[model samples]
Target: MYAIHSVLAGLLAGSASMSALEVKSEVGRSGEDGIFQSKGIPSPATNDAATSANFKLLSGMADPNGASLDVLHDGRIPRSEDDPRSNFFFAGGSNGGRILVDLGKVIDVSSIATYSWHPGSRAAQKYQVYVADGSAEGFSAELKEDADPTKAGWEKLGEVDTSGEQPGQHAARLSPAKGKSLGKCRWVLFEVRKNPNAGPFNDTFFSEIDIIDAAGPELVRIERPKKVIRQFGSKHGNFRYTLDVSAAPDLEEWCAEHLIPVMDEWYPKIIEMLPVEGITAAESITFTLRNPADLPQNLRGVPAYASGNSVVFNADFMRRQQTGEAIGAGVHEVVHVVQFGGTREKSARQRGRANRPPSWVTEGVADYIRWFLYEPQSKGAEITRRNFDRANYDGSYRITANFFDWVIRNHEKDLMRKLNVATHDGYSDDLWKEWTGKTVQELNDGWKAYHKKKLGL
Candidate 1:
C-alpha cells in the first residue's frame, strides 16, 4: 500500500519538488471576491521525464487512517470545519463550485481512485468523476454514460458506491485499462449532488484521493512544430476560449501574462449566465488552435468553433487582429464551448425546441460579455441603449443585445446576472415581470423613455 503523509508535509514536498519546475497559472480574482479563490494549482508542461513515479508526493495522495478533523454532528449527520483545501464550507455558495488538480508534469497515470464520506445518508449523495482530455473544453464522465469513447471523447473507467458509506470517511479508485495512457491532468474531481437546505448539506466529504499509474508505459507525444496556441476558460464541464501569439519565441510566457488572466476573469461571469449540471473538473477538456476553415458558415470574426468537447479557432485572427480594449474574436468562440451539453440528455434539453430562447437573447448574451467583461470600453455606448427601440426587443444580434443591456442598466443591478437564468421562448412578458415587476412592453417603454431623457430628445 502507498504510505500517506500529513497534508502539510505533502504540500511542502510538492512545493520543494516544484522548485526546479515552472509553475503556470492565471493571476486574477474571479469577478466576485470571497474567502476562497479559485486559483489553479501550479502545473508544469508535459514531457517524457514527468511520469507518475518521478513526480513528488502530495499529502492528500494516500488514504488516511483517521478523519482529518473532528466531525460536528447534528443528530447522526456530521459536519467538519473547513480546511484550506478539503473543508466543505470553503466551497463558494454557487451551485457549480469545483476542485481541480494539476498532475504537474506527470505522465502514464493508469487510473485514479478517490474516497469521500457521504455527508447526509449514502443514498442521498450522488457523485461522479470527470476527465478532461487535456483541452479545457472537452471532458468525459463515468464510462457507462458514454459507452462510445469516440463519440464522448473519453472513456469513463468505472464508478464508486456511496450507499451505506459513513459521512466521515469514503474512498474510490479509477484504474484505466493496462495499455491506456495518461498525461498532465488538471484534476481528479469528486462531485456531490447539492440541494437547497438539504442543509444538513447533502454532499460528500473526501478523506482521500489516489492516482494509479503504470510503473512504466509509452506516452502520447505532441510532435508537430508549434504554429498556433490557444488558451481556454473552463467551469464544471464546459469551456470558453482565447488564443495568443502562436509563432512568438516566448509563447507560454506570453499566454500566462496576457491571455490566461483575462480568460480567468471572464469565466465566472459566463457560468453565472449559463449553468450545466453533471460535469466536474478532473475530466479531460480540450482547447486547441484550428484553421479558420473549421467554423460554420453562419458565424463571424475569423470564426471559432467549440465541439468534440474542444475549441478550435482561426489562427489568422490571433496573428493579425488589432489590439483593442476587449477580448477579440478568439474569446467569442470560447463561449460556444460552454453551450454544448455533456450527454444526449443535456443536449436535447439545451436544444430548447419547446422553450427555445429567442435569437436575440442567445446571441445577445454572448455579445454582451464580449464587450462588457472582456473589452469594457472598446466602443463605449455605440453598442448601448440607443438601438433598443421598442420594436427591436425581438430584433436579433446587436439590436437585441442593446435591449438586454438597457434592461440591466434601467432595472436589475446588472442584467447579466438575471439574464443568466432566463429561459428561451418563455422570455415573452413574464421574464420582464419577474425581473423588473413590469411587463415586457412596460419595460421597453420605460427603457425608451429613459434613453430619450438621456439624449434630451
Candidate 2:
C-alpha cells in the first residue's frame, strides 16, 4: 500500500488586528476519505449563509479550464483531487479575482471556512476576507483593483496564507477568537490572490466555501449521490483497483459486463510490461466514469485520460463506443497510469537537467500496449494504402504505435520495456541507437518503408 501523508497547522496571522478572528488549516488528504472530514478544523458546511447567497466575480477572469463562480457555494465538493469542474480558479496568467457573496439580509455571521484540493501548487490558499453591513460610510459594493477594502466600508476580517510544500486537501476555518464575536454582516468579499512564488498556474482551486450563521436553523448538509465503488485486486494481491460509476450510473451494467473484466486481466500485464529500476508501480488505481458535462470543455471529446493514479473516462464516449472502442481506450489510459506512476525528480537531478519525454513516445507506448498486446485482433494501428503516406514513426497515437510494433518485431523484442525505462530516467534520442544499433530517424525510415511495401503503396 502507498503511504498517506497528512499535515495540520494552526495559522493565526493577519495584516490587521485579528483579536476577534482565529484561523486553522490542514493539508494532504484524499478526496474519497479525508476531505471535509477534518477533526481539528471545521469541515465544509452545506447549510451555510453562502448557500443561499448570490456570488459574482468582481475582478479577474475565471479560468476556462476550471468551474464557474457558482461552484464555490454549490454545497458539493470534488470527488477527486484534480477535478477541474468541481473547483473554481482565476485564469493562469492573471492575478486572482474577488468574489462577492450577498446574504440577502444582515444576520449574525459566526464563522467562515474555505476548502481546496489539488496535487500541485494550486492547492495552496492565499487570500483576505472582508465583511460589511452596507451602512458604513463610503460603502462600495465593488472596489477597484488598487482600492483598499478597509477604506470602502469593508471590515478587513483577516488574511490566510496556507502556502506550503505539501499538495493535497487543504481547508481554512476563520471564526471569532475567545470571548469575541464576528458581529453582524450581510456582504462578504474574498480578495483572493495567486501564489507569487509558485508556477505560472498558481491560482488556487477553491472547491467550496462555507459561512455559518450564528442564529439559524439546524445545519442541513448537502447529500451527494451514493458512490458505486467496486474494489477488487489482483489474484496474487499485488495490485488493487477501484471502479467508480457514480457520475454515470447508467453505464454501471456495461462496466460490470465488459470494462471490469478487461481491466482485471490487462492492468497487471501493463505494469509488468513497463518496469523501472528502484521504482514500484502504483499499487492502487482508480477508474472513474464522469459525465461529459462535468468535464472541462477541452476534455469532453477525449475518450479518457490518466492523472496520478486515477483514470477518468468520458461517459458519453464510453456509452457510444462501449461495444467497440471503449474497452481498448481504457487499456490505453491504464498504460498511462503505470507509465507515470514513478517519481522522476531523482532521475532529473542526476541527469543535471529535466528532459521530458516526447508526446509521440508517450502516446505511442500507450497505443502500442492497447492495439498490439491487448487487442491485436482489432488491427487498430494498421497502415492501409490510403494512410500509408501519412504514417510516420513520430505521428503519435496509432501511427506511432504501428511504428513501435514494427521496431519490436524487426529489431529488438524488448524495445518497449527499454524505451519505457529510458523515458522514465530522462529520455534522449541517443538511447535508441544504444538499444537497437540504429538512430531514431533510421528506425522511422525503415518502419515506413516496410509498411509501404506491405500495403503496396
Candidate 3:
C-alpha cells in the first residue's frame, strides 16, 4: 500500500510541474470596430485581480511623456491611436521597463492580457511573463530585467513578441495550455522590451493589462468620460475648427471668449501668408487644452505646440497667460499648423536628410507672424540695448524673429513667403542668398548692425 501511494504522489507532482501556457495575439485599428473585441481578442477586465493588485516598477523609468504606471490597470484604453496620456510607456531611449503585479494572495489565474496602441512601430509588444506564489524558498519580489526570475523561485509562463505585426492596436492573451493549468500565482512579472530595430521612441504604448481570476465573481467594465468638443469655423467658412476642452472644463468659457476669435481670424491669415503652390493647408484643425498634470514632462513649461492638424496647449499656462500673451501664443502655434501642412519636410527629416530649415528659421517665422504681424504694439520680439549682445540670428524665437523682420524690411519684401516655400521644398543657406541677394551670414551681419545702431550699442 505504501509503494502504491508513492507512485500516485509522483504522478501528481509531474503533472503539476509540466504546466504550460498558450499565447494568442491580435492586431486591429481603433474606431467602432473596438480595440480588442473586433479583433477577437479579450476585452480588458475592470474587476480583475490586477485591478486591486499592487503594481510596482521593479526596473526602468516610466516615460514622463506617456501616462503613469497606474494606467496599465486603470481599465481604460486610449480612444485614439496616439493618445499619450491614455497609455503608459518607458522613457524613449531605455531598453524597456519591468512591471510586477502582486495579487496579495495566491489565486487561480485563468488568463493574462495586455493591450497597446500606436500608428507606428510602437504598436507592437514584446515581453516575457513569469509567475510566482511566494512560497518557494529565496523568492524575491524585486527582479531586475537582466536577472532570471525562474532561477529565483518563479515559473516562466511564455514569451510574447508581436514585433513582426503591422502597426496598429495590438492585444496579447496568455492562457493555460490544453489539459493544463497555470497553477496558483500571486505575483506576475512583465519583462518588457523595446523594439530593437525601431527609432529611439520605441517603447511600447501599453494601454491596459488584465489578470483574470478563475473563481472570481462577474467582471465589470469601466466607462470612459464623454469628451467636450466645441466646434466652429473660420470667419469666411473656408476652414473648420474643433476645440477639445474636456481635460480643462473650467477654461471652456475663456477659450470661447478670447481664444476662438484669435484662431478664427489668424488661422486663415497664416495659411494665406505661408502658401506653397502644390500644398493645401489643413482644412480642419483641432485645438486641445490639456490638463497640465496630463501633459508630457517636456511640454509642461511650453505654452503651446502643434502636431499634424492639432494644436495642444498647456491648460495652466494658457490660463495664466489669458490676460496677456494668450492670443499671441495662439497665433504662433497656428503658424506651425500652416508650416507643417506639407509633409515633405517631415519625410525628409525622417530619412535623415538636412534639407529642412534650421530650428531658428522655423520658430523665427512663427514669432514673426505672432509679434510683428498679429500684435506689433506688443513689441514682444523687440531687441533693445539690454539684449543686443545676446541677439544672434540663430538664437531662435524672438531674436531670430527680429532678424527676419529686419531682413524683410531692408532686403526682400516677400522674403517670408519665399522662405516658406523653400522650407517646404528643400531649404538651404544658398536659398537665403537667392531670396535676398546675400548669404545668411551677410544677412545676419546686416541685421545685427542695424540693431546695434538702433540700440546705440
Q: Which candidate wins on TM-score?
A: 3
Residue ranges of candidate 2 with Cα displaced over 4 Å: 1-34, 57-68, 76-98, 105-108, 118-127, 136-138, 145-152, 156-168, 176-184, 192-205, 213-252, 261-320, 330-388, 392-457
Best-performing candidate as measured by lDDT? 2
TM-score of each: 0.39, 0.54, 0.57
Question: Ten-residue segment with the worst summed lDDT in candidate 3?
Answer: 1-10
lDDT of each: 0.41, 0.79, 0.77
Ranking by lDDT: 2, 3, 1
Off by over 4 Å in 1: 1-257, 276-285, 294-305, 325-328, 341-352, 380-391, 414-418, 424-429
lDDT of 2 by residue, 70-123 (tens): 889988888677778789999988889899999999888777888888878888
Q: By how many angstroms RMSD does model 1 differ from the true structure?
A: 22.2
Off by over 4 Å in 3: 1-48, 51-100, 106-111, 116-168, 174-185, 189-208, 213-230, 234-254, 267-326, 335-365, 376-378, 384-387, 393-396, 404-450, 453-456
Pairwise TM-score winner, candidates 2 and 3: 3
Candidate 1 vs 3: which has more lDDT = 3
For residues 1-457, write the lDDT of model 1, one tens digit per residue: 1112111101011111111121111111111111111222111112222223222111122113223322111001122222212323212242322333445433445545443333343212244444443443234433342144324333223334434333333333333222344333433443333423246434444433444445543433222244555555554335544443443434445455655565555554555566544332122235444334333434335445556445554555544543542244545544544444333323333434565556566666666667555666665334334453434565654555556777777777656545543442134557678778888788767766776777666
Q: In what order do the candidates fall by TM-score, top score first?
A: 3, 2, 1
Q: What is the lDDT for 125 in model 3?
A: 87
